[model samples]
Target: MPHVNTTIIIGAGIAGVHAAESLRNEGYQGQIMLMDRDSQMPYDRPPLSKEWMKEESDNANILLRNPAIYEKLDIDLKLGVEVTGIDSQRKTLDTKDGSSYEWEKIILATGTSLRTLALVGDDLRGIFYLRKMDDAVAIRDHMQHVKQAVIIGAGFIGAELASTLSEMGIDVTIVERSSYPMENIVGRQASAYFLDLHKRHGVQVITEDAVTQFHGEGKVEEAITAEGRRIPCQAVMIGVGVIPNTEVSVSQLEIDQGYVVNAYGETSVSDIYAAGDCTSWPYQGASIHIEHWDHAVNHAKTVAKNIIHPQSAPYTYTPYFWSDQYHVRFQYFGHAKEWSKTVLRGSAETDAFTIFYLDAQDIVQAAFLANQPKHALPARRLIQQQKPIDTQALADVNIALKKVPRLQGESNTSV
Candidate 1:
């Protein structure tokens, strides 16, 4: 562990803020500097699609911390600053404004950028992507003159936006290339519940179809599907997905799908670490990259501890994430890259169910709970322990999650 007297953290999202806080909390007396390109204070991004977009809330309500809190914490927060280049040899980075800073250690939490559709009329006026607060505000402003909207991609953002727009009395039509919303993550069985939920809310969900082009004079007025189905809409919101922001790395750091890191959040280059959406770390025998809020917070804390204590324990927390759409909350834990079998508890039609995804070895890999958030915590433990489960017991709602039988000598604890 090289001496880290001064630390520089890039990107002021939840991960960076929490990393800075962890350094101070863990008794690191080094000078800390946090920089971000956004001019506004760091705010929560999850609410941008739901609560913040629906209501007129004060900026402070979304802020991760008050402006004065940074001053008290002795954190030099530089907002609206873009880091242009990084020189690993010099242990320094240059900003867009011709400013350079040297540091003993650097942490990258650049997060992600919203993916856009490159159709013929993609540059049209009323199309929007919801990733930041300003984007949400612009969508709300545009909604005043529009009666209908076509949302491309039925991912979490698109689904949440569909629900929000429907609640605001705007007719919403969701166009998805997959068979159902979030099919890749939650699988077909669980996704059907969300499909039904959207239908009940009066939102038209067009599945197994994609928007081939957008047509209008200047602004988006209609979306042309691949099947030649023309749907007229006054506005459009694209939520295909997001790509990790790796431009700031300047081609100097080791990169794969994302910045490659170890279980301790240490990048290939010593004294350099990364967290949040911009990193893919080793977990449960796989190199996985998670873009959820909980992973960001946990990764930051683990990285902070590893920086202060070189021999700190590796990060082993099970990945967790949740989404809110209509009146239901969907929570998931663990990662199931591939599952041989799926065991269901309760009925999806009732909108109250928990799903257990088991791998080929019959070990619980991941679990998804819809409208039943309490099972998330226990499900996480089951994944972490890699406990083999009886399929029948897993499917029985009468058998509590804690009472499920495990393999041989493995014991289940009450959660």
Candidate 2:
């Protein structure tokens, strides 16, 4: 084993913090430093859009690890510290506080920043974007005084936030440019289910429209649509998307959709690696970037292991993500750009359904489960195998999912 004198991990989010813990568990006695700009201890992000957005929930339970764990692991956790630049040649980093740190190995897990709207009055006080815990805190504080909200996007974050606000008895009007909510990711039919879910809960959804301007004296009072229609709302939440935080890269690392990395999380430069949402890694035959809680945890484990065991197997796992809205729990596994056919299992009307997207060869490319969470794992395995599936049997709910046979392999165990 190569001797690692000291390791530095940038970004104290889930990925960076987990990397430090994994390194210690792998028997590395070297020094580990986890740094982040946020002063708060590392906390789970998923809750920020849901429970933490509510008035009752606090940060008490969202912490990823207790302070005692970091002390016991002897990990140097420096919060509220901003890393200014990285000198790849010197293998050292400079902080904004005029301090330089040297490391034998470095992991760049700097995540992402929210993409803001370029419309007029974007800097208005009540218009907000949720990305960090502090952002959520601000939104929660603002949400208390507002009776209605205008959400600018219909992505996962937008949908989840709409649901949270609706549960708080605030009227939500979701403005989406897409024809249907989550249309780009889950397809039209599945998106309709989410749209219907929101409408049933008394949330108004405006499709094929966008908010182009905010009008108010100081705080936002109304959102003007591109069609010239003015929607009155006290609060506005923008969930357009997120951009990778590559400022630290400074042309030092290759970047595409994000920081380019190999399957083992190795960047173009040696002794440097990147994981989490900031990384774009090679998958099957494509370079894919994933921004999900599970991906962060899994990628950190892979990168940490590869750092310890360079000759280990490459990182390979099916992508999985879930969203909770109202009473529906939506789960999806795998990724697909274009699928030839979509096979439906169960009844969509009853809200218990699973859709399997298949390619031209009838191989499972992706699967979306709504309210039927039990089939999530089985759907992931089908994608991993990439074997042709029985379309007829897949549509028949009477036939067990595990009993569905593959074109070349035996029947998978029934879930």
Candidate 3:
């Protein structure tokens, strides 16, 4: 292990905080400094889109860890300190508050920034974006005064927001650019199912159209679509996407839309590491980037372990994601870009279904479970094995999914 006088972590979100905690768990006694631009305590971001918007909560409610835990862990937490630049050679960083600090090692978990619309009426009132706690606080406060909401995108954030607003008795009209939103993640059929689900819940979904401009004097009174459809609403939430917050210039630090890293979470620069949404790490022999709560927690922990034992600790992460929409829980286990076949285990109308993605060899690459808690954990564990499963047993609801997977070099029969 390298002798470290101090370790400074940028971005005090889940990734940065977890990295600091995991460092202590890995038996590190060196000085650990956790810093972020936001002044508030580190909080869970996933809840902000759903529960935080639906319920009444304060800053303390969304905190990732107890306030006193940092004192016990001996972590130095610095808030509202915006890191402007990084000197990879000097092992130091500069903050917006005109303070400079040097460290033996550094980790960048800067996360992401919300992508906003740059149209003519973007600066109008009642237009918002949800990425941080402050944003959620503002949106929640505004939701009380608003009767109708027009969501510009139909991604996870958009869908979750629609569900939350609907539960709050706010009329929601979703304007999606893609006819089948999130088809890549949930598949085409499930995408259609989601559209129908929202419609059945009294959500007016306007697909194959986009908000071109807002029409109002000072406040946004109406949203004009590209197809000339005008939507009147009290509020508009934009959830197009997010851009990686990796602006610091580090010499030879490779960045392909994000800070590129290996399974070890080590960047091209030595004594410097990165994780979370701001990184593109290796997975399944290829490099990919994931932006989700589970990925941040798992990736940061793996990175923290490798920081102590750089070579021994490898991140064998099975990407996992889940969303709570209305009364149903949606979960997707593992990652898969392409698959030869898909097996459906349950009916979609019943709202308890699992769609398994398999390659040419019939090995499960990924599985999407909708309101199927019994199959989620087991599917997550078995997908990592990359073994073929009995199709007949997998499709049968009566058969246990745990017994459907065949061992290595076994016949095409369930174990």
Most accurate candidate by lDDT: 2
Residues 296-335, model 2: lDDT tens digits: 8989988999888883848887888999988889898988
How accurate locally is residue 340 in candidate 3, as Cα lDDT from 0 to 100? 84
List TM-scores for all candidates, in order: 0.95, 0.96, 0.95
lDDT of 3 by residue, 188-291 (tens): 87898899989999999999998988978888889999899989888999999999989865869999878998878888998788989999988777788889
Identify the runs in model 3 with alpha carbons over 4 angstroms from their true place.
1-4, 405-415
User: Could you tell me the TM-score of candidate 1?
Assistant: 0.95
CA lDDT of every candidate:
0.87, 0.87, 0.87
TM-score for candidate 3, please give it.
0.95
Q: Residue 58 of candidate 2: its Cα lDDT? A: 75
Residue-pair clash count for candidate 3: 0
Which portions of model 1 show Cα errors greater than 4 Å? 1-4, 250-252, 409-415
Q: Over the stretch 63-84, how does candidate 1's per-residue lDDT look in tens digits?
A: 9988888898889999999999
C-alpha lDDT (0 to 100) for residue 200 of candidate 3: 92
Superposing all C-alpha atoms, what RMSD in Å does each candidate have to the true structure? 2.6, 2.8, 2.7
